[model samples]
Target: MLKLREKLLLNTALLALVLILQLAGLMKGINTKVDSLLPSPSPSLLSVLTAFGGDVFLIAFSLLTVLLDVRNSGKLSRETLVFLVSAVIGLVIVGVLKVAINEPRPRNHGGFSFPSGHTYRGAIIAVYASNRWKRATPLAVLFALGVAMTRLLLHVHWFGDVLFSLLLAPWVYSIVKATQDSWLPLYRRVISRLGLGAFDVE
Candidate 1:
């Protein structure tokens, strides 16, 4: 397992690289070239898959996963809370960056698109799921990649947007994991005192 400091350093470096690329005016060229290569042959199919990365879908999925884990284990694990909390934080960060940077989407779309929210959600979910089930890592990765590709195919985001979102996943997970480890005991005590101890799984 990676420490929180290492994860932070890695993500910070990647973010710096993205900023440098943007400053050098290379993101546009890269986005245009990549978009040109991926023509949308089946919009409906890709759209359906892309929806899996959306806020509604991801939140619902997370809730369902937590419920299922509770059903099976008779307790809510720290992992579930970590996943949910990290996802919410990631979304907030992306939203704030979108507003602050005010980067426009591809093809004259109105909203900011410096970092793809759908891609970020997809990557975060993939990382969380893979951590829970190691055997599913490949599938999770493919799902994340597919979600990122759909954004380009649909011309909703630039290549740099999706790339950065993808890179942010493990970093978010690592941070959340570390936070959970540090705070779960206190959280458990509070919940247990309130008679909701079933959620106190370590």
Candidate 2:
């Protein structure tokens, strides 16, 4: 498993690299170049596949995992809680950045689109699932990559946007892990106080 300190360092490096690329004026060129290579959108297959990363699908998927955990274990797992919290926090971060940066989409889709929300959520779910099931790392990664590709193909996001989402994923997981590890006792206490004792997963 990746440690918190390593994740912090990696996130810093990624942010620096994004800044450097943006400053060098290569970000737009890169997005344009990649966009040119993709074929016009086909609403059937690509639409179906891309929905795997959609808000409804991802949210339902997250809840389903939690429900499954409860069904099998009789209590919520800390890992599951962390995954849900991380995903929610990640969404908020993406939303804030999208509004703050106010970047536009590639095909004039008419909304702030610095970062791809689908790709971000996909990365979070992929990394979280991979962490839980080590053997599934390749599939998780491929799923995330496919989501990123679909965004680009649909002309909904810039390359840099999805790149940042992918780069930020592990770091988000790591931070959530570290925080939960340290504050778990408090978390348990709070859950107990709230009459949700079944959620107190060690």
Candidate 3:
């Protein structure tokens, strides 16, 4: 018994499934192009978006999400925590894998090339959209996809890097949601102990 809105959203999500699946082609030079024609994010735009610092946009967005929770009287949205935790988990997983595997980047790159951070961030943004604006999920996802494309076109990261993040976003989000559901009381306790009483919420 799905409402029209839910049905429409489900349909769109299905389409996203297809496209995201297809992006796997670029994950590890797996049927990928050494000379992909895809345009990268514009240099100026890259300068703007990638400026600040390590995951600057992410930090800003994460902080904003936290502030929004405060404004909402400490009632952190399940979606908000999911998005943040997913991104963080993705980062941590990448680090763990990098160290354990000692995986090298695509030669001459600054970091490992398995999963792309840009693509992962893009996917994370889409995860956040799912909780906040389900109807606009597709568009938000496209923007993230665009960021992945920019990374390749600009040659900052390799295909595998882009592919990894693309794959990681949704998975991390699910993990975050599951983890949050299982640990709400813990979250509540931590918040209570933080002396955020006025801003405390579930």
Evaluated with lDDT, which candidate comes out highest?
A: 1
Model 1, stretches more than 4 Å misplaced?
1-8, 23-25, 189-195
Poorest lDDT segment (10 consecutive residues) of candidate 1: 19-28
Pick the winner on TM-score between candidates 1 and 3: 1
Instruction: Give lDDT per model, in order.
Output: 0.84, 0.82, 0.64
Q: Write the per-residue lDDT of candidate 3 for residues 43-155, one digit (tens) a residue.
A: 88775654321387778878888788778765666677667668878788767655654445543657665556667776787668756888988888777777776677666
TM-score of model 2 relative to the true fold? 0.89
Instruction: Please write out the lDDT profile of model 2 over residues 1-202, one tens digit for every residue.
Output: 7566876887879866985685566698887888888787785787788888899988898878878887888788777888888888888888887887777898778998867789988999899889888999999999999999888888888889899888767667777887886877788889889998567684
Candidate 1: the clashing residue pairs are none
* Candidate 1 structure quality by residue, lDDT tens digits, 1-202: 8665876897879977986786577788888898777776778988898998998899799879878878889887767778877898888888887887778898897899978999999999998888888999999999899999989888889999999889877677777787776877787789889998566684
| Reference-based lDDT, residue 95, model 2 | 89
The RMSD of every model to the true structure, in order and in angstroms, is 2.5, 2.3, 5.6
Q: TM-score per candidate, in order?
A: 0.87, 0.89, 0.72
Ranking by lDDT: 1, 2, 3
Q: Can you list the residue pairs that collide in candidate 3?
A: 40-150, 41-150, 115-161, 116-161
For TM-score, the strongest prediction is 2
